[model samples]
Target: MTLDPEDSKLITLARAARARNGSAEGAAVRDETGRTYSATDVTLSSLTLSAVQVAVAMAVSSGARSLEAAALVSEGDPGSADEEVARELGAGALLVAGPDGTPRS
Candidate 1:
């Protein structure tokens, strides 16, 4: 599945976060799994919507059993803009899983 516009916004903010933090690379916190994953840390080459789908699929098929209890950004910090993205995306529940293995909250 493709990421919704809200998700796109969130990703943009994430990239911005990396830029602000002066890190060329940073992890996208997976709310579902409370895991920090890099765009290229696994098989994902791009941060596109399609990549998110693939990542989520891989995570589930690879024995990740319970993402419901996980947090989306366990490491890097998300700015208010990012938080807004999440809010707009209705990802504040920590119960909804995104296609990229990130929690909706």
Candidate 2:
């Protein structure tokens, strides 16, 4: 499927994050101003966060008041928390892609 250039960029960042970190999931988000943040899942003994959740946190911490879009690259679907966080931040859509960077959801 054809994707907008910016959206495609998000997927590329997410895919790279996954590959670089050897993580199960990766995610990227674009803020209202077009700034983007990317992250991999965080799995620690005391804390765990989805890739999308981490990406949202990065955007928020960077002073982004709202989000434009989000992209998640994973073998499985994004969890409800991931979707909710993005929505709460005013993201228009949380696009989903397979590990291979193929759009799936």
Error of 2 at 64 (Å): 0.2
Among the numbered candidates, top TM-score falls to 2
What are the lDDT scores of the predictions, listed in order?
0.37, 0.93
Off by over 4 Å in 1: 30-105
Q: Which 10 consecutive residues of model 1 have the lowest summed lDDT? A: 67-76
Candidate 2, 1-105: lDDT as tens digits: 888899999999999999999999999999999999999999999999999989999999999999999999999988888889989988866899998889986
lDDT of 1 by residue, 62-105 (tens): 56543322123223333454344334423353223323445444
Please name the candidate that would achieve the greatest lDDT relative to the true structure: 2
